[model samples]
Target: MQSDPAAMPAPAGPRENRAVLVDVALALVIGWILGAAAQVAHWSGQLAPGRRHGPGPTGNEAGHDWPRWAEGMGQPPPGVPWPALIAAVVILLAVALRRAYPRAAFAGALVGAIGYVAAGAPFPVTLIPLALCGYAVAGREPLLRWLPIGVLVLPLAVAGWWQEAAVGLTEPGPYGVLLITAAVLASATMLALLRRARRDAHDRERREELRQAALGERLRVAREVHDIVGHSLSVISLQAGVALRVLERRPDEAAAALRAIRGSSTSALTELRQTIAAFRDDPGRGPTAPPPGLDRVDELAAALRAAGREVTVERWPDPLGPLPASIELAAFRIVQESLTNVVRHTDRAGAAVLLRRTGDELLVEVADDGPPLAAEPTPGGGLHGMRERAEGAGGTFAARRGERGGWVVSARLPIGEAP
Candidate 1:
């Protein structure tokens, strides 16, 4: 079964969801390990929840006497309490959104950082959320998200510096550094995935367009095949049947009918070959010379005139001058096909052909005194073929009923005025 074009797969779906889930789990694991390590290492000096020491330092306040958990300078210096728990949660959130809702995870990390700072979390623990937010937001969201991230950075950095000051130089603990690395990696990975998605979308669009064009071309070829074979065979069949039925009575008419059958069969064979050849090789690259051009306008007009119809021809001096072969061929085909349609469909036997150069444009117009076919509302393939020729040559073609009940086919080809 052919798939509906509208139901094609979108760029985001099940795979993306799975990736997000994995990222979240990984983040949670990382956060848990970090929190547990800090707690067990005495990083926050085991301050029991809601327990207050007797006498505090000079600047330390009564209720805000720097909880042991929140006492670290910048990072949550390897210790566990309420702060460690929150930071770990933030990490898990960041991981969850790494693939899917990156922006949400990014914002959540920043919020988690603030929560950790206010709750007197370890200095190292706070930095984790800050790094996560900065890395996440900068890559995906607008730069405005950076403002809040920037606000979080100041406190986190200060705390880190304070801790470094408290502990002597060369305190190479993996606190701020690890968070920065993780954030950078996350941002890069996110950007890479985004780029891949865009490229995939672009490829899909291109393929769809080509597929549509190819289908249209196939339909056109089918119609042409019908016109060539069906029309020819129908004419031959009718003539042969007439000839067979009237052979004993109307000898002369039967002979004429037999000749017409022979003629139609020959023409059909030729047309069939041409149609099959077109399938194997594009005419543009074939040995066949391009179609007729503006020079043939008078001949086309004369042919119509000879058939008991009046034809008038107007030409701009050298409008057919050394033009690109493609343009010349296109203009010729447009006028030829238009004239052929007039011959086959219109009641009027004659038409006028006009070709003029207006500045940088060439205009070809074929107008007939024939009324539009009210019953056959759909435009025929001949007219469509002419329009395609004009458009393929970087021009515009229009065919409409004229004010005087006649029909007009006009095509404008923008030119560069041949040197």
Candidate 2:
């Protein structure tokens, strides 16, 4: 199981829910707007031309009548009685289900269209429901490239051609209805595909970010292990050597050395576990131990002092203000790792640590007054670990030969505003 939040698929939040509702609402709004536009075009034409194409009753009315189209607006095309109201209900149901069920929505829209046609309603009015389902079909159905245009557009066009368009109201002609239906469905389909493409792109970016975060997290754990176990091992090795040297003639000194080894090992184990658990978080569970920070720097120096190394800590600005845990922890890790390298690589008992708060940044430098380092500095796990810790905490890190002699490790870490 992935422990990272970025790795998990996001739940549909309020914004997504609102978006779905908006799509459904837009169906109704778009249909009404298109219906009204058709009305406007119908009214734009003269009543004389409409009388040519529009149906009417006898020879006297039909001859030279051009046609007999009525001009009005009602839910069921201005005639055909109260039974035609079911068409509106079915169309509304189709619109509501468009996002959730494309096939079913399409079926409902078709049924409603058939109902309106059966009621002697204008075919252009029925095209509204059919066009509304385009979004759902284009988004969810396969063969989507031309499927929506073919399936949705052709039907509305055919129905308009077969029926007297101005059944009760002067509506758009078959060609007008065809163009309007195709335009709506095509627009809806294009919009749906665009939304899908954007969503897929967003998901890809999120996954890439999660991959990078997981990689960075793993590196952080490795650094923690190197700092914790590496220092402990170094201390343990030194203590063991001392114990061996004094065991023959001085039992008390050897016993004290053994105690130091035990202490370091136990502390290392406890902290190692805490660091591991911090990353492997679970519901209602958290790291049991507080992370080591600058407050523990004195304790680190004291430990080195007891281990026969003279380690001194100098803090400029006397005392730092309350610091962010991240900055403090990074500083502590750098100091710890730097001191460990001094013991393991240099045959010296003296190392100096400087901590200074400079504006929005904190500067930490650890320099050992030992013999000069190699001209070509060899890369080691300890140095790499220290560098990673500093940079990982949004800091700059460099380890080079000191001006005078020995090795100097410096880090400049960003310190955000204190709580």
Candidate 3:
């Protein structure tokens, strides 16, 4: 048994079908220009007016006197044949296909021009298709290959010889119209080249923009992982050490230390999975907690307390209403990273976390009574990640030695329009 070919759905249209429609209109206009010019006169000596040749074309006959020097010699036809007219219609249809098949259209038109002369046919009209085709294909191809298309102008000049025979003419002479034809083709080719160049430049800029956006996103994810996993691992290491030291004596205290380790590890793994899923664009994974924000800063301090470090938080003009999500996230991460650094780099040092808000800005500061902080960041360092988050949120960041002792980290983030 055979399947029905017509039953299959048609393939979707090209991405740029709108351009193809414009080409159809351009094709019709070119067809009219050539069609109107072909009907202007018949220069064949046998068909000239007052000759005995059977019934010359009755309309649009030329008023100029025939050249005296060419009384015997033949002149190229000012009109084209029926076959040439049909070829032109086919050429016009090809012109409409220019958007999708520009090379084919140009090749067909070039072939038509060369075919007319190769068959010994005489006419100025045959070359019009080649000039029209140049608008679409000439500039798109290499210069060395398409230059030959300009050679057809010689025959056009000879066919227009009657323009020279005209006496007292205000219009251009024989080569004047020829110059105009060449000018038209040249203008078309130059314009095509310019458009192609502009499109190429736009493509380059778009690719660069996309590359930068991806880089920024990856850096953002790295900062997130650094802050989340770094803080949790610090607490786990401290709690595990405590549990091992008291395993034999003080069993209850050891059990409590182990429980803290389990809790810290579980929360860190969940947050890590969420960040990885977002980076991979995996929406179907397990539902995740909302991003940590300024509201979670107290939780960070409480965790540090569990790891046997004292953290004091002070807020002035407490933020009664919700701030923009970006500012909140940046502020929370700054505090979390500062505390983590104290835990990892110092021996049970006490820390202070401070947050304040103004009309349109939030200020976050963290200070540890430990040795001076030295930030020689290598890719995913805590100080660098905090600075990046602050600046990315359209804010400022600073890390400097405290006036009396220790190290201080501060950030200022603006509250922009919220979604």
Candidate 4:
């Protein structure tokens, strides 16, 4: 019995699930760290008095020199009960949605960054979520779409700095902040592009592998169809010719030949349908019938004898032990093709088939005792296919003129036993 190909297990789900989990966990961890840092900076600002206006007693601020938007305003800044809570929620939401909806998450993160700046937060705190979102967007979106967005970072930073300057609230480090923001965005975009390129390379390699595998399967099926139809048609053609020649003198013999032709045609049609169905990917078609093998050799010899050829088969190891079906099929095809060649190329030739198993190898040999034909036989698809089948089964095949002056074909197939 043949097993259904559809019954094989699928391996895609678990790997994809694991990747999603990893991305989500990493996002959460990064969001947590950024939120904690923002909270610490907010607390430091609250504890220091007049520090936003000028340097502290140490002649330097606790954070970098970026201008603070809240310090220059005449009115006191509105207080939030939990400033970190808003930033944390926004950052986490953006990260969680990054993989599934990258563009939306990226836009949300940009809005959050603008809100952070407007709320008088530190510049470094605003950068965390923006950088993460930029990376996500670059990874998913095409270069033409995301590259321009990345380039806009420089102009946006300059505009914000210019607004601060118009109000006489600009610090001496406007260019420093602009360059830093641009560098962050550029670096994130470049890394994401590299990752996308690597993923594309891997996808291409996988597709190539699948294509080559499909091509190899096609060749294998073609070879099988060629051997089956070729051998069967050869037998049928020879039988039809015999039936035509004897139709006038021997009516009974002609009838028998016609019956043999019908039998061969019917068997070929059945096998052709099975071969085609095997190639179909539909599970509803069910299992295919087992392929022909050594057990059918007797039926093959009988058919040839009925077609006016004298053929003998010998099995030295009678009641042969179990063998792999592939080896058996290759063996059967070699013998079948050899007999078919004899019928086509020789007149009244008698052939002998010998099958023997010794140790780890199964041997098959076919020899004909007829005199050489007037023309030398040219190698054709049959000979090339036989060699391929034997080698594909991890076996060896040879065809040459025998010492007794007739064509001999031989093959030795490995039986999966330890050598």
TM-score of each: 0.41, 0.71, 0.76, 0.76
State residue 233's C-alpha deviation in candidate 2, in Å. 1.8
lDDT score for residue 306 of model 4: 87
Encode model 2's per-residue lDDT on 1-419: one tens digit a residue: 55999887789889879977986786667455434433433333212122334455545354332222432432222322332355656776777777677777777777666554444344555555676686677766764343643554444444433444544234555456557766776787788788788988999999999999999888888888888998889878877888898999999988988888888889889999898888786768853788999988887777666566888999988888888988898899999988888889876558999999989999999999988766946778877877777787788999888887887899999998876
C-alpha lDDT score of every prediction, in listed order: 0.61, 0.71, 0.69, 0.74
Lowest-sum lDDT 10-residue window in model 4: 46-55
Query: In lDDT terms, which candidate is top?
Result: 4
Candidate 2 lDDT trough over 10 residues, lowest sum: 42-51
Candidate 1 lDDT, 1-419, residue by residue in tens = 99987898677678877766766676777677656744643443432222223446433333244534455464555523666576557766665565456567665665565444334444445444445545555555555644444444434433333433442124443344335645654565467457666877999999999999999888667755654565455445555666787899989878888777676678668756765675665656566433345676665555444333577878786545666666776776676666666656665446788888777788989888776545333567766777777787789988887666568889998776553
In the range 164-282, model 3's lDDT, one tens digit per residue, is 33321333443554576577778878887898889889999999999999998878887898888889998888778778888999898889888888888998898898778767756
On lDDT, the stronger of 1 and 2 is 2
Which structure is stronger by lDDT: 1 or 4?
4
lDDT of 4 by residue, 3-41 (tens): 888997666588767867876786688667656655555
Q: For model 2, what is the alpha-carbon lDDT of residue 202?
A: 96
Q: What ranking of all candidate models by lDDT puts the best one first?
A: 4, 2, 3, 1
- What are the per-model numbers of colliding residue pairs? 18, 4, 0, 0
Q: What stretches of model 2 exceed 4 Å from their correct place?
A: 1-60, 63-90, 110-119, 141-149, 161-179, 210-218, 273-289, 305-307, 315-324, 347-350, 356-361, 369-371, 378-381, 392-394, 414-419
Cα displacement (Å) at residue 40, model 3: 3.7
- How many angstroms is residue 22 displaced in model 2 relative to the true structure, after the best TM-score fit? 7.7
Which residue pairs in model 4 clash with each other?
none
